[model samples]
Target: MKPARFFTPENLQIVKRLVSRYPPGQERASLVPLLDLAQRQHGTWIPPSAMQEIGNTTNLSFEQVFAIVLAYPTSFQWRPCAPQLRICDSWMCCQKAKQRDNGIFEAAQSIASQYGVEVKTTSCLGACYGAPAFWFNDKIHTDATKETIKEIISKEFT
Candidate 1:
């Protein structure tokens, strides 16, 4: 996390959007989104330069960057992030993770990827309280229903 990072003009817009989420005096709070942008745009994981960029853009110290980066369990190896969305299929969810009209999650998977979000059926997303849950881009959506999937697709991928 020592070197600075450079971004293409298009990707720079994303950085700006992430940075805009915080108040003027709380720029450092944008670190999470900045790191996510770095991983999503650069692929696999956030490199040293990306951490440096986050720290520089947020006007934080290298030590701050080091601590936060180490705190999160970001992966070094790439997975199915090309549109990764894992729907919970634990016993409770197996019954709920479905289209209202169907008994399986196949339709949900199809609908998600049709809108450009790759998906799978997994056991748990730590949202037992919300039986039907899904994980996308490292964030979890609890109480996921058909309408929820549609809305997320429209709001985020559209």
Candidate 2:
């Protein structure tokens, strides 16, 4: 069978460096960081080829790596996604949304869909004081409203 090659030479060096951080026989410990690096380098998703390469580099089975990746949905992106819109749907944010009747998250999903952005609901964004928070491409925006959400999505496309 042909070898699976995905990472660039520099990224391969980085993968080796990450693997070297652990004790000689514990390269499996580098799996998560290696997946993270591969995701970042590959523009946000880890493909099967990269998983195979990572397994080979770390002396892990392909199934082992795939299992770990599947376990952490938020950490790894198995497929490509448009810019993300992660809305906080935890207690404080939901309560605030209900009180204000702004439908911030719903509007965000609507706006994101128009722009081909992906919307995900997260537990907490750590901005409870400024509830109704969300992350546009990982940048937190607290005290958000539907208009603000629309504006943010609009700015992203333009």
The candidate that achieves the highest TM-score relative to the unseen native structure = 2
TM-score of every model? 0.55, 0.62
lDDT of 2 by residue, 44-97 (tens): 778899999889889998999999988987879654565888899999999999
True-vs-predicted CA distance for residue 93, candidate 2, Å: 2.3
Steric clashes per prediction: 0, 0
Model 2 stretches astray by more than 4 angstroms: 1-4, 13-30, 40-45, 56-61, 73-77, 99-101, 118-120, 123-130, 138-140
Indicate which candidate wins on lDDT: 2
TM-score (C-alpha, index-matched) for candidate 2: 0.62
